[model samples]
Target chain A: MKARVHVMLKDGVLDPQGEAVRHALGTLGFDGVEGVRQGKVIELDLATEDAAAAEAEVREMCEKLLANTVIEKYDIEIG
Target chain B: MKARVHVMLKDGVLDPQGEAVRHALGTLGFDGVEGVRQGKVIELDLATEDAAAAEAEVREMCEKLLANTVIEKYDIEIG
Candidate 1:
């Protein structure tokens, strides 16, 4: 099975990197870009038998190590 | 218009950050995880009248500033 985990910065957290990119984009005449928030996607290939089990494990992976709950949230997509 | 940009490290590029996350996930007993690759997603809310033009400009944004083409590739999704 394959899984994709999306980790995003919490709404109130300041994302300087994303901001910088946004500024640069605006300078290049790509206006109408309200803002940019940078997030991460982790693609995983699991050696598991059941999709349910893999989903549960990947959720743990995000909660424990892949994301910082203080400033981020994660969602998992399994295939 | 709204667009989502997915930027991924080139297959051969060395992603130390991702490797570290993989190692930590492994230590947490999430076994059978072969490896992990990390990427970024930027969701854009465009104040534009046309999707085609916005996409072309965003592609330029990726090429010039949003991602380092030396070891990255970007895909755009408009909705």
Candidate 2:
């Protein structure tokens, strides 16, 4: 099975890296970009075949290592 | 409009960060993780309303600044 995880900052959190991107875009003449939020995507290839088990395992991984739960939220998809 | 961009390293390229993550997972007892690939997801809030135009603009942004096309590829989704 394969698992894909998206880890993004929470709604109220500030993202400095995203702000840098938006500022750089403005400098490059790409106007009208109101905001930008940057996040991480991790794709994992697992030996397990059961989708449910894979998802559960990946969720645990996210909680334990992949995400900073206080500031970020993660979503997982197993296939 | 909103645009979500996913930027990933090309298949042949090496990802040290992902390798480190895999190693850490192993140390944490996450066995059976065959491989891991890490990527970036950027969400943009744009002032434009036309989805097609937003996608085109975001693609241009990816080509010009968001992605290092030499070793990275990017996908853009507009909504």
Candidate 3:
């Protein structure tokens, strides 16, 4: 199974990386560009047969290493 | 309105950041976790009323700034 995890900064959290990108875009002449918040993406190729178990494992992966739960939340998609 | 942009590395591309996180998670006792691909998250508290135009702007943002289009792709959601 394959899964994609998108972990993003929560509302009201500061994102300096995204801000930098937004500014860079403005410099690059992308006039419509506004704001950007940068986060992490995790793609997993698992050998497990259980999607439920994989979700749990991935959640633990986020909590422990992939995300700073203090300021970010994650969404998971499995295929 | 707010929009969320998730940019992820395409399959076959190297994601050293995610691999590092996955290794760290394993070290931290997340045993079942397998692979990880790190990406960028952009959160926009857009002031625009047009979701379609905003989506276009964000797509440009991703192409020009938030993601390295050479190896990454993005998805945008507006609310």
- Number of the top DockQ candidate: 2
CAPRI band of model 3? Answer: medium
lDDT (10s digit) by residue, model 1, range B6-49:
89899999888778877887888877898788999887777886
Stretches off by above 4 angstroms in model 1 are none
Candidate 2: what is its chain A TM-score? Answer: 0.97
Q: Give each model's whole-structure lDDT.
A: 0.86, 0.95, 0.76
The true-versus-predicted C-alpha distance at residue B21 of model 1, in Å, is 1.2
**lDDT minimum window of 10 residues, candidate 1 chain A:** A24-33
Task: Give all TM-scores, in the order shown.
Answer: 0.91, 0.98, 0.75
Against the true structure, candidate 3 reaches a TM-score of 0.75
Complex DockQ, candidate 3: 0.55
Instruction: Give TM-scores of chain A for all candidates.
Output: 0.95, 0.97, 0.91
Residue A3 accuracy (lDDT) in model 2: 91
Candidate 2 lDDT at A75 equals 97
lDDT of 2 by residue, B1-79 (tens): 8899999999989999889999999999999999999999999999999998898899999999999999999998888
Q: Write the per-residue lDDT of candidate 3 for residues B1-79, one digit (tens) a residue.
A: 6788877788898878878877877788766656767776677766677989888877776776777888888888988
lDDT of 3 by residue, A2-70 (tens): 878888789798888878877777788765545666776677877687889878877776787677899
DockQ of each: 0.79, 0.94, 0.55
Question: Which TM-score values does chain B get in all models?
Answer: 0.93, 0.97, 0.89
